[model samples]
Target: MVKPVIAERGGAAAGDDARNGERAASVRWALAGLSLCVLLPSLGISVANVALPTLADAFGAPFQDVQWIVLSYLLAITSLIVGAGRLGDLAGRRRLLLGGIALFTLASALCGAAPTLWLLVAARAAQGVGAAVMMALAMALVAGTVPASRVGGAMGLLGTMSAVGTALGPSLGGGLIAGFGWRAIFLAGLPLGLLAFALARRHLPADRREDRDGTTGGTADGTARGRAGFDGLGTLLLALTLAAYALAMTMGRGAFGPLTLALLLAAACGAGLFLRVEANAASPLIRPAMLRDPALGRGLAANALVSTVMMATLVVGPFHLSHALGLDTGPAGLALSAGPLAAALAGVPAGRLTDRFGARRMTVAGLAGMAAGTVLLSGLPAALGAALGVAGYLAPLVVVTIGYALFQTANNTAVMTGVRPDQRGLTSGLLNLARNLGLVTGASAMGAVFAAAAGDVATAGAEAVASGTRATFAVAAGLIAAALAVTVAGRRARPGQTADGA
Candidate 1:
């Protein structure tokens, strides 16, 4: 009897261990799927940017019309990200993620097939909506899936994947454009999107919200079970605000007229209305109280600033490389790849560093590096005739990219970790919102500055391009410096804050 009992106990223990191992494997696969989800959209955006001129030529559209391809995507994401995140929180995140992948894949196919510029722009807008949903839920999924101690590392890995996708995008797009056509850029997303969807469906667990009884659903946490009602009014107001703001910014540079002023005023009114609605709503799309948290607020500001600086560089860098240096499309794309490549290589290590040291230190260091690189790049025009001019240009990119990698990983980890489990979705949305807003703002602002300095490139020639590039870099450096100052001040104010809690 005693021997039989012992054998049964041993068998049960072995089975439990096997189950644990299986669970671990599932989580790993789920994370892998999420990484791919993050990567594909990132890759798509960068690749599209490289193919812009080709797109213009193919469609017989002017530069201004072609600009809409990128603008429409940014506008859609800015408008929908927060709402999609809130919906994910109420519904299942996995469900939203899968839906997003399907939409994005379909949109990619549509974009590739579109014959007209307007239709392609519309398809790109659809793709942006899907990208927003996936981006908003990605960090929340990471927080929910990984152990608290490992969240930083996981966030780091996702960051690395994003950087790698971005790094490879230009090169891939250039190659595709050279070999096939501009349409191939959109077609490329199909396979990657489908693969991610399948993996996510197979490996990601069902929604697991904790209640008072430690059960799946209960009233203990103050969250209602089932579908959280959508905030249609809030969504509309926010959309209006973002759309107006983007329109004004993008159009304002070309001509500062009554339309720009009207759009700006509309954006302000929409913002005010959105704030009023959020403050009064029972199930608010964004929690007013959470924004007051020092860690979350400051972290988001830093994120926006960093994004602004990076986007400014990306927008202006290609122009400088091609027009000023006389590099071909492929070589220009390869040159631009340097920054993201450095960022990708540094991303994982930066996350590990964030986990070891606090996020504040890493953020500060990263911003400082960005500031330095921008300042260096600002002087590149004067050195163009020198032997080291190319080196000078490439070196700053490496520095800026490294800084971006460290700052992004640490800052994202800090913000997500600082939030409550239930708030992760909204937090993720806000984080991405800041980033998209920054991208639009940066591009518009830099473009205007470049135009002002360069003044009709057809007449001004290479000198105009060089002058504008310098001015843009100088302005970017200043913005980053301001961000660095804000970060340091916030850190000093909250000496006890850390990013390990989430």
Candidate 2:
């Protein structure tokens, strides 16, 4: 009798181990699906950056007209992401994600086949719509898909994949265009999008039914004084506000004019209207009170500030490399790649560190690291730059990128960890929106500063270029410092999260 009982117990243990292995495998597959969803859109963003010139030639259009292809995509994503997140929360993340993947794939096909520049721009905008859904929902779904203890690791993994997509896009697009033409760059996404859809359908957790109160399976609240409807009026107001701000920043490149003033005024008015509408709406797109929450609110502000500094590097690095260092296009491009490469390599490890250490500690560490790097960049003597050459610039840049990877992972983990299930999608959207806005703001604002300081880049000397670089990074350092302050204030306000977001 004793021997029989021992045998039964051993058999049960073996069975349990097998089940655990299967469960782990399932989680990995699920994460892979989410990763692809993220990677495709990131690739879309950077890949097109490399193809702008090719597109200009192919469409026989001026650079200004061809640029709308990229602008439209970005504008669409920025304007629609919050609404998409809200929609996902109401409909169900899994179903909406699948639909998003399908739409992205279809849009890619349309983009590849477009015969006119305007048509291509239209398709890209549609693609951005899909991207908005994927981006917002990916992080929103993390809690549902992964164990709480490993949320940081999962977030890190997503960040790593995103960095990889960004790092790969330019080189990948270049290679494809060399052999297959510009259309191939867009078309390349079709297979990956399809795979993402299939894996999402197969691996993502099934959505459960939600009560009418908008405490739902996906993310974000859609309750309107106890009923359910999309907040179209609210979305429109917010979109118009964001669009106006974006156009204000982007149009006329580094030069500001009357139109910019008009747009800024329009955005201000639109923002006021949006807030007023949300106050009385039965179903406001985002609850005004949500912004009052320190975690979500402060986290967003910090993300945007950090993102602004990062974009400054991208906008300024090439000019510095070419003008100050006298590097050719080939070497400059290679040097530019270093930042994203560092980010890609560091992302997962940074996320893992956030998991190992507390998010607060890691966040402080990351911000501090970025601060130090930017200070170094701003103050490095011209003699030292001449003495050290590329190493001088690249060394500081690598530190900044690594720090950015760490801070981004920690900040995102911190924000999403404490969010209500009913608010995840919208919160994620807000974070993304903040980041996009920061990037847009940095591109235009920072570019303007550089231009102003250099005084006609075409005629500026190496010393002027170096001065511009220094000044840009000096401002960037201040932005990071502000971000640090935001993070610290939030930490002080709310001492702990449900878990140590590692």
Candidate 3:
């Protein structure tokens, strides 16, 4: 949610003043278009996971190559989001969104028709670029179109869509694959893209025009506008650091050997370089001033931790049910839905709670819930009855997910509220970057922890799976506990003390 520069009077009211009915209707349709475009790429991220086995068999690529199809999309989306958002500010968000939809739709077609594995991979990367554009532009469009008072509600909807799309991606893809084969999964985005494209063309408002006539409410022409640069050095360094580090983590301890060691070295060097460059640049990719705010710091960290727990549950929980408990895929999949469903159910109430109590209290409570849930999840053993086992697993997952949703909603609101209006686009980019990084970091780290535990276990059957599951949940609990501690300490040091002191 971008804070409007016109804070004394919100843009939505101004938009209403600009013209009551037609302009307001335009905003609604524009928001709907942006929302739909945002949904497709997020759906793509997880949808492919369900189709990977089918893809590998069809293309005869190595399993590792198949993994790149997922990794590349994550890498591109995570790395390019900030740049894309900046591009939207420099160019126009509406133009960028339309172009992105076109490109994305075309890329989906390419993916669906690829004759070989490499072509499909290339097409997926192209799709990632489009995804980045859509995601980066969507929020900015909302900020630009929606009135300030309604920004909260609008952003809440965006957040819900992102969360819901992520959870639904696998199930939706699974259904597509089951009914129509792997290609259908890729093609699924086509209709969505087309719909968004048509709606945006029909209803999205034009960019603010610069008039030369100097009429009643006009500004002079030839006013010098500062040129925005891409921070090429910072961008290069950040890309190297994030891509290399993320890949190294995902590759586990020794998968890449000497190359991994080299990548790690490069990542470290890149980080130092990025910091120095950003500090000196006229228009930096990330502003150093923004990091000084306690609100931004806490919000970013809390969301990262929340993301960590959220992804960890999704990555590890199902295996615990299916592999360790000998449940079939159908039942295991059903169990996995508990968390996301709980998250969806909890979002609205959580928002009102945040509005009433401020973010700090809600964030702390959420972490506490996650911690308790993780601890309980870690203690589950093999002797329980089916109903008890289901209850034990589902209950903790629901609690943690609900906590995560609340934490995310409150944290985002707090962060956006803390920043200056003009800086909202940059702030949104950074927050999202934190989230993607956290998603990759948590999943990789937790998977490594689980694998390490399983490696040390002496038993070769159900006992080993049990030990691994227990160990994973134990580590997850510790992570959530650490997250809780961070939240507590951060809240205490917040710059502005409200009634809730959040």
Best by TM-score: 2
Q: Write the per-residue lDDT of candidate 3 for residues 1-502, one digit (tens) a residue.
A: 3455566468668777878788788888877787787678878887998889999999888899998888787777787777776655555566777888898999999999988888888899889888878877676566567775465456556666776777788899999888999999998888999998998888876654221111133112443324455566777677778887777766654344787778778778888888998887865677676676766776777677667767778767766776666679888988887777787667667767776677667778778888888887788765552347667678877887887777776666666655544455556667787888788777777777776766643344555666776788788887778777776777653455563434
Worst 10 residues of 3 by lDDT: 210-219
- For candidate 1, the lDDT comes to 0.82
Cα error, candidate 2, residue 295 (Å): 1.6
Model 3 per-residue lDDT at 252? 52
lDDT winner, 1 or 2: 2
Q: Model 2 over residues 243-350: C-alpha lDDT tens digits?
A: 889888878465778899899999999999999999888778987778778778888998999988998999899999999999999999999999999998888898
lDDT of 3 at 172: 94
| TM-score ranking from best candidate downward | 2, 1, 3
In order, what lDDT does every prediction score?
0.82, 0.87, 0.73
Predicted structure 1, TM vs. truth: 0.87
In the order shown, what is each candidate's alpha-carbon RMSD? 3.9, 2.7, 7.5
- Candidate 2: Cα lDDT at 43: 97
Task: Give the clashing residue pairs of candidate 1, or none.
Answer: none
